[model samples]
Target: MNYIIIKDSQQLTEVCQKARLADVVMLDTEFVRTRTYHPQLGLIQLYDGEQLVLIDPLEIDDMQAFSELLSDTSVTKVLHACGEDLEVFQHAFGCTPTPMIDTQLMAAFLGYGLSTGFAALVNDYLSVELDKSESRADWLARPLTDKQLDYAAADVFYLLPLYQQLLEQVEVKGWLEAVEQESQLLVEKRLKQVKPEQAYLSVKGAWILKPQQLAILKIIAQWRLLEAQKRDLALNFIVKEANMVEVCRNEMTSLKEMNEAGFDHREIRRHGNTLIEMVKQGQAIAESEWPAKITRLMDNPAYKQLFKLLKDEVKLASESSGLATEFLASKKQLNQFISWVWNKDRNPEQLPDVMQGWRKEIVGEALNKKMS
Candidate 1:
């Protein structure tokens, strides 16, 4: 397989022209992001059927043409486990590829289980084993090794053919539209800014906090996220959630107390004053102004029974249909359904936005039937 390494604007333009002619293209990216809020795009590998191109973003200044090709509605972009890759593209190019297909999703729709890794999927579907030893190679390093180039090239080279096979199977199974809808959500731009006060919801122990403590933690978490973004560093580097929770629970008002709680000393030394101010601001907010408490529906026996019933039904349906139970309806969806059913006054049609298509088909009808 001949692979073309595109390191300049001219090569990018030439490749974009060829890519625009294809009905679909396989897309993949290589990056390093362990330390940062955003991925550092090291190499972009794309296969448009006839040519395999490895784009060196470091050497190229203008990727506008390539970006346009991605956003073109006429062309479809095929990827495997593409959520992070899609996010990387949106961050770098300010656009996402349209009409995308995620082979991982396709595999699940065909009963290959949710969350199948790329190499495993390749082995199962194509009977080809992928060399994954270079998975952690430094993509940003100059003078790419022959083995590293081959590893990157292999990602997209077989994807075109794999996509063709999956497309046919999904169409036969009549779940193509379902997978497409899910892919649309994956390709959409992630929120650039989230309210600092709402950040605590992502923390694992957030539910353990009282409303007042939660409000304080929310403010601090939000501040930490902003700081991380400003510094282009990971959130934990700015402040870990465990320490934030400890600070809020203990009501640490002074730098001395904050330091003793195992919080990063440097973070305390640098942002302690501002953190104290935010905590005070959070405390000043009225009780009603605090974020609403997350109510767990499973705490009620009636709802728990309903949830179990839904889970059993989903499992039975998955077995009969040869699809993963998770593909039909997730645990979160089941809980949401129970809550909707419990609230008699709430309209049944207004289920969570995430409840759609095959999920709606499998679970929605049963829910409506049970409620009636």
Candidate 2:
């Protein structure tokens, strides 16, 4: 198990040069993010057709060449379950690899499974049992062990072979373009930053708040977003959602009031006044400016029956089209569809993926027929 460790400008330059000439390469990253808003990149693993290398971002001074290769349009970037890896690459190089192939998505496209792991894919395709001992290694440590190196290398080493097979199969099924479109959209979303004003929508239990309380929740949530980004801290590190919701619900106006509202956090003591100020500003907002109360579809017997019918339609479509049921529409997506049809005001663009693209042709028509 031999591989090169690229820790300097010259080694990186050579790797980038070789990568540009290659038609496709496997990519993976190691990072730690338990304490921060963004994962701290520790290692990047790459596999050209013949060589495997690990790039140590902690030791490398310049990454421009590698970044260029990532953004290079001609080279196909191969990865597995790339949601978090795409984020890591965006943060590390301020760019995302394009013309990508996500083996996980490809597997789903082939009706294998919705969220297949890399090890499972390897076992299914190549009969290799991937070693999992170093999967949880502390990659940020100064010296990554040989076992860790082997594990990391194995992540990308099998990807190229997997990609070749998947490409041929998808092309035979006439699904190559559809798969690429889905992966491209997924990468673009992972690379985009969430807007502070829209951050409240991500807070848990937000839908339970009344219109005015939701206004306060929005203000506090937005402030938490900005503070988290500024300090490179997790949102909960600044203020937990429970405490933020409590403050907004009770209209806590001071540090003493925060305690009275049952919000107890050590970090809150440091920023209690700011939280109160945000609540006060939110309260000052005119009634007309308050957001409308979120309308959730009730779990009534009648609506439940409709949801069941929709699921039946999805299953029928999956069987007819020979696509994975999970890929066509998950239970979660079905619930979203019910909410949109019942509420009538939810954004059409935010509708489930089944309602658009190739999925619409396969499953959405059946579901829509049931609705009518």
Candidate 3:
């Protein structure tokens, strides 16, 4: 396959102009995330119907033209499993490609199963074998091997054809709107980083912490997030979660107990004072200000029956709709729905995804009847 390697601003501009004229553009990205809070974009692969090109982001001085092309509303951007790629674009250009459709999302709507790999989708649709040997290649290295370039090229080469078939199936099933809504929601969520105050919820084993402990974790998590972004270091490199949890659990106040709190002396000299102050502040929090306990309906035997009913509804709905079980109604969404129904104190007006949109048409009403 013939592919152009674009290493300069002039070539990128020319490609963007050509891309603007095309009806659809297929895109993929290669990046490294081992060291930094944000992915370091190494390469970008683009296919505009007739042309296949690899643009080296590390070589290009300015990416404004390419970024503008991505933000273009006129042309549709087709990608497969695009969550991380979208994140790369957001970080690189400060804008996300729009009017986007993910082949993976369409495949699920067409009943191929959710979370299908890009290679599997291509092989299933096009009868082409994709070489993933270079899938873990060091894209940031100065000289990329021919095999590596071939691997990158293959990602977008078959996407256009796959998009066409997927599009037809989605249109036939009358699910184009749902696919678009889900894809758009994903893009929006990726673009909007979670707030620092809400970051603690993302910490592993966070739900195990008491309200006061959670308060401390939240402060430390927020500080760690900001520091990671500033220093371009991974969160674990800054402070391990287990250690942070330990400090929170014991309410460590001084650097004297640094080792006992599960943090090393090096970590202590760097962030001990600030972390201790956050602990003190968290310790001083009023009882009313502490976070509410997270209660699960699954713990109750009475609610267990209700949970089984909801699960059965999801299984039946999945069979009826020809959608994957998880796609139809994830366990988390089902739990939320159950909570809404069983707990009168929970908001009925606030429906989970399983209870809204196309899902409402799938199993929501039936589940609501069961509750009634």
Candidate 4:
């Protein structure tokens, strides 16, 4: 493919200015995230039908032009499975691409299944076998290999063509707006990074812990999250959640005790003292200050039956709407809705996933009616 590699701000600015005039642009990104809190953006691919541009993020310091291009409302940006791509844009450019559509979400609406891979979509629709051998390439490395370039280019090159098909089908089914909203939700989700203090709520086995134990877990989780964010390291690379729970429950005091418990030596060495300190801080927390006890959804005596009814309603909605059940609502979203309804604290604010956006007009309203 004949593509321009934008290594300088001027080239990027020129290209983005030209792309802004285009009705639609294809977008994708290559990044490394192993052991990191945020994705290390390596490459960005763009195709505006006229020009194919590979943006070398490491080389280009000023990304203002690209940021403006993403934020441009008139020009629609097309992407495939854009959840992670949005993360890169949000972190690097501090903006989400406006007027976007995710081909993956589009596929789900068309009954292609939620988990369809880009390779499969290309092969099935465009009759192109994507070279994915370089999918795991170290994008952060300099002098990207020919295979890596080929792999990266293929990601955005055929997206417009695939999008054309998706757009046509979605429009015919009157689901274009739905797909757009779903894409925006992906962007919003990236911006909703978990706060450090609340990180313990996401840890496994946290629900069963007593309030005082939760206090310890909360402090430890907060410390881990802050440490990870500060160091740009993955949470588990610092200390596993299971280990945190065990340490809190057993009340291990010394580094020697943690080592004897088979804790990872590197983690013990790096964060052992901090972890011990966090336990002490947590124990000092008063009863009023302890985090609220977590109520596991599955613990409800009527959970299975209620879940089955909701799922059955989803099946009916799917058949009626000619959409995938998974597309309508995932198990987690359903659980969220159940939780929101069950909690006495439930109100209009921070509605469950199913009860938001286009879903409200489709299945969410009916689900609410059923719950009522």
Clashing pairs in 4: none
> Model 1 — which ten-residue stretch has the worst lDDT?
185-194
Best of the candidates, TM-score = 4
Ranking by lDDT: 4, 3, 2, 1
Model 1 lDDT, residue 44, Cα? 95
Residue 293 of model 1 has an lDDT of 69
Instruction: Please report the candidate that would top lDDT against the real structure.
Output: 4
TM-score of 2: 0.93
Per-candidate total of colliding backbone pairs: 1, 0, 0, 0
Please, what are the lDDT tens digits per residue for candidate 4 over residues 1-372? 788788999999999999999999999999999989889999999999989989999999899999999999999999888888888888888888898888999998888898899999999999999878888889999999888887888898899899998789889998888887788888877689898879999999888788888999988888889888899988898899888988888777799989998999997998889888888888899999988888888988999999998999998899998888988988988998998899844578979878888888779988888888
lDDT of 3 by residue, 145-260 (tens): 99999899989888889899889989999999999987886787677787888878778777677998888888899999888989999898888887788888888888888776
TM-score of 3: 0.91
Q: Write the per-residue lDDT of candidate 1 for residues 1-372, one digit (tens) a residue.
A: 799999889889999999999999999999999989888899999999998999999999999988999899899999998878877898899887787889999988888878998888788779999999998999999998999999999999888778888889999999899889878755652434567657788786777778888889888888888888789998888877787887777767899988777677788987788878878888998998888765566567677677677778778778777888776777876766666667634464766532455666666676656655
TM-score of every candidate relative to the true structure: 0.92, 0.93, 0.91, 0.96
Alpha-carbon RMSD, candidate 1: 2.4
